[model samples]
Target chain A: MFAGLSAFPLTPLRNDEVDEVAYAGLIERLVAAGVDSITALGSTGAYPYLTTDERRRVARVALEHAGSVPVVVGVGALRTSQVIGLARDAADAGASGVLLAPMSYQPLTDDDVFGLYEDVAAAVPLPVIVYDNPGTTHFEFSDALYARIAQLPNIASIKIPGVPAEPDAARARVEQIRSAVSDRVTIGISGDASAARGLNAGCDTWYSVIGGTLPEAALAICRAARSGDAAAAMAESDRLQPLWDLFAEHGGSFRVIAAIAELGGLVTPNSLPLPVRGLDRTARDRVARVVRELGLIPPA
Target chain B: MFAGLSAFPLTPLRNDEVDEVAYAGLIERLVAAGVDSITALGSTGAYPYLTTDERRRVARVALEHAGSVPVVVGVGALRTSQVIGLARDAADAGASGVLLAPMSYQPLTDDDVFGLYEDVAAAVPLPVIVYDNPGTTHFEFSDALYARIAQLPNIASIKIPGVPAEPDAARARVEQIRSAVSDRVTIGISGDASAARGLNAGCDTWYSVIGGTLPEAALAICRAARSGDAAAAMAESDRLQPLWDLFAEHGGSFRVIAAIAELGGLVTPNSLPLPVRGLDRTARDRVARVVRELGLIPPA
Candidate 1:
């Protein structure tokens, strides 16, 4: 069911609690900006960090606020039982689909990975998206594993990483996955910097991070690629180069984007969890300048 | 307060719930084997996978069953607030110390790492053991970071990885940590294979995994090193060589040891969480053979 651009909204926090008001506003903005989907409890959402109660609350808020936009709730956990529990919670909260990742402290074999997805898919009525993020989960799925997982009932799509730093390799990798999986399972690419190249390689969707805070800018880039307008897509990607570069430099942009949202008066300050220090004054200024240049900040 | 060998007991599961009865029995075995300390919710206990209530129950059970043996509870989490919450819960359950690791889905800077420990230490009156396991947490601590963390008022000790596969390097690494931190803060080394080398390096404590399951064998190695008998330490380590080799081959012995514990009639079979598959029939047979040879199985 994943296609076009899906905005992964950051879970704004207040007083160590999920800021439902702020999250609702964020999702409303994504829907208003014409995003194809809104993903709550994603990596950007700090799904692992939040308690089970908070995840359910976030999903409810995102789904209620998302309205016309489909809301995909991330249901990844260390155990299949836990993931299935979260999947049921997501379905109960009225999420569009559940995104599952094989997250374990211990190494998992391909059979173990297959079994995890199979159990969750069987338990949940909602479509399940296999999130193949080896960088975080440390469990990479081979082509054979992907083919096997694709055969699971209710398996919807696969979200593959597109290393923005290596655009050519990113495109090739996405194309390889596109060829490996069944046609029914859509291939989506993450990593904002690789959006243009990945989409140009015919990836069906962009599971995006920056797209949450700057949906209009992200939508333009995705739309350009969807129409096979490589030049237009590259131009939009180029416009967002500074932000992508910042994300790479900092390891990730979850905190930086939260700071940006705060700076733009989108969310209250100190919305991120503890120890996730936002950009220092100088770096925040640089991000502000880039966001302003792209017309993302200052309330359009 | 950490000294000698601290056994990290695994949390046996039944029907996906923490089998407190089995856990208490495991703690009883560790105490009977004369382990110096018992860590209730350490990595081997699968603390991260358990729910907050389950962790609390496990901590209570370990402390109650541990009797005189000091119980240290692992309280690491992705959020500072959650870590502090766990620490408070640990203290209330009469845990001797709380183990804190800089766990994050996102890579953390040095400042971020220090801030996490400081906040948790200040918030909880209980002593906090800085757990530096980069392989799992993905957040490595430098000597400088260790020095900074040592300054926290309630910070008790640091549990650093001992790369059992490389004994020479492991000794050097433990020595470096000993020199970097103040003598007031104890230094405990984990990884069963590195116990003899780490203890030989004048490390204050051994935070052991296999020690919980096979405490007699682990305690023998620790006692040999503690008494300044290098030859005896290596001999004891050699006695358990097969098990260490299995751990190295399987990425970790968390599941392998779980299987061994079950085979020894310590816990019921299938105690490990799903996706964390135990050794197959053949591998289990091999582990069983090693356990039997070491006299770790066939409980007395």
Candidate 2:
């Protein structure tokens, strides 16, 4: 079960290979910041873009540096058997659990989606986190479907992405899911700008994007919200507003977050996969101003 | 460039490994049927679901038995660098060319789409086919975007999946693209039942699903259509109606085609990737009747 801020680590690359040194450094910082959990290979981590070999390596490296915190490896794929294979590998690599999304080229029936999770969960002893990211998967789970999936054994958590423009609606959706599922199941929320709203609505964990690179700030927001200190939570959310605005203006948070990590010297400046590009010069400069204003970059 | 009926061979599996013997036989049949081109690792061929090594093997096996016909290997992936790498491998494996779709998790801008094709086309020495399949990729190319992409060096063809229920609309869309691009680029249409309409509307090729397993029937339809024999073309189409109706109902043709290939004893009754399932018992019975009626199944 997860609580507080679950950091989705940004994948650091050097010379076209995953930079283990930089990646470990990022994880160590999150651990030091007392981030509740580390979800490796999340959307920000470019799980779909990596090769199977690369994914295995990333999962292994993440668990190695996670220390006491659980490392949830993203194991989503086009095939159920492939997802099962990844789950086996993740368990063998000592991952805490596997996060699965029903990803497919063809439109999948509700039964097909349920079958994918059931088969994978049955194959591995590890816990499963159902990832509902409609933006990437183009497969949305209705509340009824979510409630149904929550009944499967070993399905430990559900990460629901918050709707960007509607905080109240997003919070209400989380509460609805929360009311439907068992208390044993952990329900978390993703969407950097809306994480506080999700927390206020009683989602137990913040599956965050900016939190992957800016853990201290994310933990502060989580701590404030969890303690019912709305003013403090709003201050942290307001401080992060500039970056969130940039992410909203662009398509999503992946590129802008990577840009901030690079600018802050958290990880080496790296190229994202083709078509999902980083911020333009103007946007990068804006990101730099926000990073400086928030004191994210260490003193030279 | 491609012309006439092009076969997209199904990837057969035996104990989760690519069945080399079954695959080779499938390719040999296409060559014998005088298919103008062979497209390996297509949607029906399950390209995205396969591993990198499996995809390379599929392409090599395809080229090996393609004989006199050109073999176009699908090289699309979620990453640009990955696509370039696959294109390089396709060329190395003696493939005639590569087909690419702007596959991504992020919603790409028009400029991003153009850039992906440009970079991949620049990296390889083979002709590139721009695949515009919105059903799978969810990335639609505006006609202006298609015209721009067609202008890129080494881009030889465009595979446009037909608008199934509307032939006139599909034909008009094809004409718009045809008028926008130079004559050097060949425009082909996919969707088995609509192939006759596409050809009648000036599409140069039938990029087929049934053609992969039952090449003789697909070729007969194409031949009749190309020779201005409307009655013969319609007759062929009407005969194939049961199968085409299945494809339209299923949302995409991959599963139905895979089902037909299995029912006809084409490739040892292969397993398609998860979520892309074959027909149910009732649908399978319908497919069996169609296969028997059309004499697609070879004699024991």
**Candidate of highest DockQ:** 1
Among all candidates shown, the one with the greatest lDDT: 1
lDDT by residue (A20-98, candidate 2, tens digit) is 8888888888888889889999888888888888889888988899899888899998877788888888998898888
Give the TM-score of each candidate: 0.96, 0.93
True contacts kept of each: 0.72, 0.77
Model 1 regions lying over 4 Å from their true place: A163-172, A298-300, B163-173, B298-300
Assess the local accuracy of residue B112 in candidate 2 as a C-alpha lDDT between 0 and 100. Answer: 84
Interface RMSD of each: 1.4, 1.5
What is the Å distance of residue A226 in model 1 from its true position?
A: 0.8
Q: Summarize candidate 1's per-residue lDDT along B138-209 as a digit string, tens digits.
A: 787889999999988988898878744466776777777778888789998887887888888778899999
Docking quality category of candidate 2 according to DockQ thresholds: medium
> What is the lDDT of every predicted structure here?
0.85, 0.83
lDDT of 1: 0.85
